[model samples]
Target: MEDLWQAFVNVDSAGNITGDYSGKNIVAEDPYDFFFLVDKEVALSLHEYKVHLDGFKPSLVPKQSAE
Candidate 1:
């Protein structure tokens, strides 16, 4: 038998972690990967995750305009 571990991450602007994953020193450059890690670590059901995610909204990067 194997024991599975999970971790929830919350990052803010400037690539700084600011939530459950804070102080872990894990830096991420891609928002998709970052959120994916968070979602995976949560280990929650789809409905539960949707409710949780909706309640805890994270900051998103602003889109850059083409010159």
Candidate 2:
């Protein structure tokens, strides 16, 4: 099971919005429900979430080879 999914939106200087998910076009007129699930109970929108993991830097640990 995948725990995370992401979508990126792009807009040019002309204010043209563009995005795609899984190779399909993103529709701006569609109703988008961005939310967060906590402890299998609470819920929050994309803006309401407290912690943003994406901004954090990754660890420099080297991968262990199984060979």
Top of the candidates by TM-score: 1
lDDT value, residue 10 of candidate 1: 54
Give the TM-scores of the predictions, in the order they appear: 0.24, 0.18
The Cα error of candidate 1 at residue 51, in Å, is 23
lDDT of each: 0.33, 0.26
Lowest-scoring 10 consecutive residues by lDDT in candidate 1? 45-54
* Over 4 Å off, model 1: 1-4, 21-67
**By lDDT, who's the top model here?**
1
In candidate 2, what are the lDDT values of residues 1-67, reduced to their tens digit?
A: 4333333323333222232221123344543222222221111122222222234431111123111
Per-residue CA lDDT of model 1 for 1-67, tens digit only, reads 3333333445434333344321223544433323433333333321222212225554333223111
The list of candidate 2 runs beyond 4 A from truth reads 1-4, 22-67
